[model samples]
Target: MKIPFSPPYINEAVIQEVNSALESGWITTGPKVKRLEELVCKYTLAPNTLCVNSATSGLMLALKWYGIGEGDEVIIPAYTYAATALAVIHVGATPVMVDVEKDFNIATHEIEKVITKKTKAIIPVDIAGWPCNYSDIYAIINKKKELFIPKHENQEKLGRVLVISDSAHSIGATYKSEYLGKITDITVFSFHAVKNVTTAEGGAVCINLPEPFKNQDEYNYLRCFSLNGQTKDAFTKSKAGDWRYDIIYPGLKMNMPDILAAIGVAQLPEYFEKTLQNRVEIYEYYHTFFKTKSWAILPPYKSDDKTSSCHLYALRIKDISESERDAIIDKISKEGVAVNVHFQPLPMLSLFKEMGFDIDNYPVAYNNYKSEISLPIYPQLTKNELEYIVSTVTNAVESSL
Candidate 1:
């Protein structure tokens, strides 16, 4: 009855895809990667999509493209994974840590207050597959339109603040009838093993920019940037008598390999309704079981206006201290049910604390951290296994208290 937390749902199909890729000699950042990018665009309905090695790379690329550097500031929720904030620092910008709301996502109402003249971008994280309240954040951005400085002094007004979404936990999520990736200026998706879909370790960046970037050349430039800023891709260079090329810029190498993309391509057609539906079933089961427990503050279900990917089933123990939370986690593990914490808040981590970030400043994020626990939620769990998990959690929580 031992249940592990967040196991990768790999099967024969994934193996078969990998085998096909191995058979094909051209496996490094080739046609398969290109095909996955195209499928991602079609699924998300984004203007353009670029596949990368990981979501961390995708975030860094987005920030770099937006020209966020030294003296620039990026606003992000303190409750997210460290990678979200680390990506900002990697771009040589200061990450202004902000408190998240009670739901473990960005504090939309408080974002406007944090916007300063040096604010170059706002990275709102979609925690545990729940999309942040983008409408409110968009309202704040729209009202502060005067704060934006155009790329050129007399050119058409382009918004200075880029709305980059850290959508690593939310690929199938929807916001206001549109997919999460298509809703933001730049949205990044993680296809890590434990994610809803897996490319072993991969991600994609989808851009929804308007106006000046409407041309195809703009998309081509983005593709070029992912491949060491080369004028042409390896696929193009492999063509007859096309070996000659030129370097455009000093770009980083974060291209997705065809071997990884082969899994993605095979998984895409089977993913849409099948993978998500299984996850939804798991989520709904948890919801039903936790309904009678006053101590359990269940994760949000899909509303008429929005839908989550149900990536993680995070349960909060009402009125519990941090010690109690830790004890509960220990008890669950002892009973053969592995439980985990979503995050510990960036300001509390050693590196961030050494960097002079104080945890007391973000009370909501700390409070969320104190009581939260992420249970096992994946596509492979059977009815018996799910019941075992529920009973194990129930026994653990009651005994721990």
Candidate 2:
């Protein structure tokens, strides 16, 4: 029984929604996209949300909206998807890579060391669906606001160095009793096919800022920025008598289409409990099996104040070289049971190396990357298929020794 990594769980609802969009003729970023954005905002309990083409775009827009650019720096976990750091660079800001904690999420304690005069923001990623220590991050940000970059004399008084979260893997995760989207200044969610909740190819940014930035009416302005930084979106300009609009800024085209949002809106109703429950069951199955293995170090599950979204199940084999990890993956694939690695630390990748980052400097991230392996935990896996996966992993591990 060949068990693949993560086959998207699509049903008739998704297909019908797409068919409806195709039939509507207004399949671009139109009414359906607006409805999806509303659903996302309601689900995340966020004051505002903007749907975009991808999570990378969501992160880039967040950084741009916060005015982080040249002469500024943003701290990020070295262990996250490259998209996290790449978004920082996309906005012309320096990405200060920091080591993660033993659990493999961003180390909240280390954020203070990297804080400097140029530090404009801190982007703590919720790697593998486990929420970062947002309370600690919030405490640190409030206590150390003096270390952040000073506000421009002309610009409005900025809030504390913006706490943007790369919550790509944590749509349903909670930190300190609040959902991920509400726990930070800004949070980005990826609805990629393999994610916990999928929209085929889509993402959303949830804004939880205080005061003047909290205007509910600004959602249209955000949609405009996503379209092309224009004063009016294509939807408004397409009206019978309103075709004129002005460019507000040099923005990029990354808006989510109603075609994609159709899937999103259909999938959202099943997100909170049903989909999450299936993922959790898979997670628990893996945990029950691997916890007894002496060489297998499991990822974090429980925390003092957080609950995971049960995203990626990253397992580390103790005392193994990076080559050994690769060999294990090869062995597993050979058994017709597909598996994958979560990420290679950004600094180890050539793009980052060219940008003057050294992998050796981030010892913890390198260590985590070398020892880690991600198992398939999607909802579609049957009980028998899961058993095969577990047996295959067990055989591969014992054989590797």
Candidate 3:
């Protein structure tokens, strides 16, 4: 009974959609891509949505759109995957690292402490599909509005710190009974293979800017930005006598093609109807199995105001060193269960270390990382597989202890 971690939910419907895309001949940034964007807007209730090749690119685009650049600072959680920090770095901005709360979200007080005149944006990550406290974060941003010094047009228009949600793990999750995308200024969702909704390798940027900043206008500009600044996509150019186009700004080649978008198109309906429900059930099962164990620190998946997408069951073991946790993971693997760590804090990684970041500075992030094990929580896992996973993890933890 070999159990793999987080496989994509690819049914016959997904294959059929891909087949239809292949047969259409207009496979690159065509109708399917537009359709996927529409479906995302309809589901998330965002004012506008733009599909991109990856969430990294979406973050970069958001940063660039806000005019975040050299000498500017962007606040991010040290506990997140490197992509969050890397996006800031790619835009030539400094990533101001902050410690996370016990629930694996950026500390709002920490955010307020580090904010300066140079702070341009705050990228709060929804670790393991659990949303951060947006109401508090927004209040903090508004409280610090006088300190903001806008460097560009968009920055001036926004008049405060931008909140670009690193929502790669939290598309279907809700914050305060509202979907994540609409709750923030801008939310980026990943459709990577292991995500709850996959497009093999794709992402979407949802825009929900306030008055005086038209979301449709922003969406249009971002669409062009994703396509190397071309005024028209290949699909539009393919139409009779529509070859004429213009290069507006030097942009990135990050647009999603129809073929990949097809996967998301097929997956969205099933995701809302069944896939997310299955993941919630699996999450509950894991919680029920581990609640009695004193060593078990269960990941938060549901609350009165928030409901997780159940992306990762990031269970933590108590009183274990980092080395001990690694040993437990190895033991579980040997027993034919595939488990993983959510992340090593940025300061623990080689890149941030050379940049003069110390893991000790982010004690909470390091503490969270040391004993964490991400269990499989996907739509495809069977009941037998779920039981096997818990039993295997329990044996490994007790033995390691």
lDDT of each: 0.86, 0.85, 0.95
Task: Tell me the alpha-carbon RMSD of every candidate.
Answer: 1.7, 1.6, 0.7
Overlapping backbone residue pairs in candidate 2 total 0
Q: TM-score of every model? A: 0.96, 0.96, 0.99
Worst 10 residues of 2 by lDDT: 150-159
Candidate 2, residues 1-401, lDDT tens digits: the string is: 68888888888998999899999878888888888888887887988888999999999988887778898999999898889998999999999988998788888888988788788888998889999888788898888877665655212455578888999999988887888888887899999988887888989988887665643645556677788888877777788999988998788899988898999888887878588888889899999999989999998876778888989899899989999999998989999998888789988889989989898888888888898989998878889998999889889988998
Better of 1 and 2 by lDDT: 1
Per-residue lDDT of candidate 3, residues 1-401 (tens digit): 89999788999999999999999987899999999999999988999999999999999999999999999999999999999999999999999999999999999999999999999999999999999999999999999999999989998898999999999999889999998899999999999999999999999999999989999999999999989999999999999999999999899999999999999999998898888899999999999999989999999988999999899999999989999999999999998999999989999999999999999999999899998999998888999999999999999999888
lDDT of 1: 0.86
Which window of ten consecutive residues has the lowest lDDT sum in model 1? 149-158
* Pairs with steric clashes in candidate 1: none
Whole-structure CA lDDT of model 3: 0.95
Give the poorly placed runs of model 3, Cα more than 4 Å off.
Answer: none
lDDT of 1 at 256: 90
